[model samples]
Target: MTRFSLNQWTTRHWPMPDLLAGCAAAGVDVGLWREPVAEYGLTRTAKLVQEHGLTVTSLCRAGFFQRPDALEDNRRAIEETAALGAPVLCLVSGGLPEGSRDVDGARSRVADLLAELAPYAGEHGVQLALEPLHPMYCSDRCVVSTLAQALDMAAPFSPTQVGVMVDTYHLWWDPAVWDGIARAGAEDRIALFQVADWVTPLPEGVLTGRGMLGDGCVELRRFREAVDATGYTGPIEVEIFNDELWAMPGPAALDLALSRFAQHVV
Candidate 1:
């Protein structure tokens, strides 16, 4: 199978300690989230991961530059990522400010915000990885909707300081995705690769309905091969957001994810 990494959200109901232990037992690395880390106590969480000999592939996440507290929150996230020994901090740039329809302005703000945080991330020895959500989420979830846009936001910083996440779920519908991945690789801007299939008839809030691998038309292996062709030897994070998986027991969910990842994402 591919170098699989379990994204914390994929098993959102899994307690922090169990998640770490499960990953260790499965011989898999993990991608962690801030809320769970905080709930478990950041220092303690970091220590537990270390004790389990588990690698924190990436920390999820910090962006939302439209808020006044964005900078401070992101700085803290950088510190958290460093403390956890995670090499990358995933960033989901916030959408248009309340009552505002200026998409261009929101995009511009992401560039400015990245410019400010890139240096701080570098200081903390973390790469800020910009993740572009699907276009459907452009209004309320993320202003950056395409891999190309994410790459543009990351262009100002060196790959070590800032980079892009190639998430199959979000960019699968983009015709230019292959080219965008190539450009990101050529520019040395790829930081993470996330795998999730896409299904239609999106659910309410359009956030948690991601398909299990091979359950949709995402061309999973093609995406991986393209990413690997870029010489990106990073962890392939499995980030399914389906509520069905969430309701299952953590170990069962992890087993299912691992099985699908091996069958479809390799």
Candidate 2:
């Protein structure tokens, strides 16, 4: 029986205290986020999680490696993740910085940064999970936009220090997606598995318009089966960024997510 968690993006309008309470009310055991915890102060946020008994699945992000000035920023991200007691810290190798069009250069910089931070993350018992964003976001979002690419980038580091996140919304269209999932699991490199549906013609490519589970065409069960085949039984985290959902109340949005997770993902 796999557990289900909700990403904070689903309830971004709610305060940290309310988010934790909402997750608890919905019977969600895990929560994921990017910089929200730090913005709210780790001590206060961690205390809230303790009071509500919620698990921090993975910090939403920690990488923007394309920037030349990213080394110190990456170090601080690792430190913050450790302080939050998050088992995994997600990374999105940023797009090319201004005045640059070299994708390979950006990737190389990401590799270098990962090499520098891997030991520190391992020492703190936090795994770095690289998330592959959709290709449409190639220019402004993550450079590693495919499961294969993310796995390749993470190959040099030990699984304890660097791993990959398999988000169905970003990867369901890849021809080699199943293979990548298998490889990640075979190598024990899948740090987290996130779920969301892919809607065509994204509005802005930055935020909003993520479909709910079973609302789009992604083969959710097939993905779950594939991941399960690889012997990866971690929680299946639901992450949706939709304007419609955001407009609704937090509890309503969470109820829909949980029901859909039960109906479509099992």
Candidate 3:
């Protein structure tokens, strides 16, 4: 059976305890998040997750190499992810810093940061999953904006040390998406498989406004077929960041998302 998980961003309006409870009530098996855990405190959040038997699928973030001062922060994020018992830590390469328009330079900085963080993450049994944001977000969100680019950066690290996060919402429109998935699997580099629909006329950059499953133009099954062909049997995590969805009760949104995921992504 395909396992279903929710991204914390989708339930940002709800408190962590309520979110976990709602996920359990909705029958979701796993969950992902960014820094909200720290706000709620790791020990308390971990206990809440345990109480509901929810799997912390992966931490939402742990990378922002654009700044010269990012190394320490990245390391701390890796340590926190390990403490959460998350098998994977998702990394967003971050945007250009002030007075820097060089995308290549940003990429280089990110590569350097990853090289420094990989060994530490490996020691903690946490895999760093570099998430390539959609090209639309290249300016303010992430410089690593494609699976091909992410794979190139990941080439030097082992799958356990570094890997790729294949988010359908980010990569669905890429012409090389399937090929990238194949290559990631061939190299054993796929660390996570995130799902969400792509709605047109995106309001802002790519952060929020993601569509619910089956609500947009993404070809979900094709993505599943590609991942399955690569021998990846991990949970298919649903990571929508829709504002409207967040306003509703967590259980209602989770139930609807799960139904859409089964009908569209399975």
Tens-digit lDDT track of model 3 for 1-266 = 24788888877777788888877877676655656888899888878888887778888786877866689888887787877778998899898887778988888888888888999999999999999998887887799999998999999998898999999999998998989999999999999999999887777655677999999999998998899899998888888888889889877887788788889988
- C-alpha local distance difference test of each model: 0.93, 0.84, 0.85
Q: What TM-score would each prediction reach against the true structure?
A: 0.98, 0.95, 0.95
Off by over 4 Å in 2: none
Model 1 stretches astray by more than 4 angstroms: none
What digit string (tens of lDDT, one per residue) describes model 2 on residues 24-99?
A: 7766766556567777888888788878877778777778887666788877777777776778888888888887
Supply candidate 1's per-residue lDDT for 157.
81
Clashes of each: 0, 1, 0
Candidate 2 whole-model C-alpha lDDT, 0 to 1: 0.84
Q: Rate residue 225 of model 1 by lDDT.
A: 95
- Give the distance in Å from residue 62's predicted Cα in candidate 2 to where it truly belongs: 1.2
Give the backbone clash total of model 1.
Answer: 0
Residue 191 in candidate 2 has what lDDT? 93
On lDDT, the stronger of 1 and 3 is 1
The better candidate by lDDT, 1 or 2, is 1
lDDT tens string, model 1, 179-234? 99999999999899999999988999899889999999999999999999989988
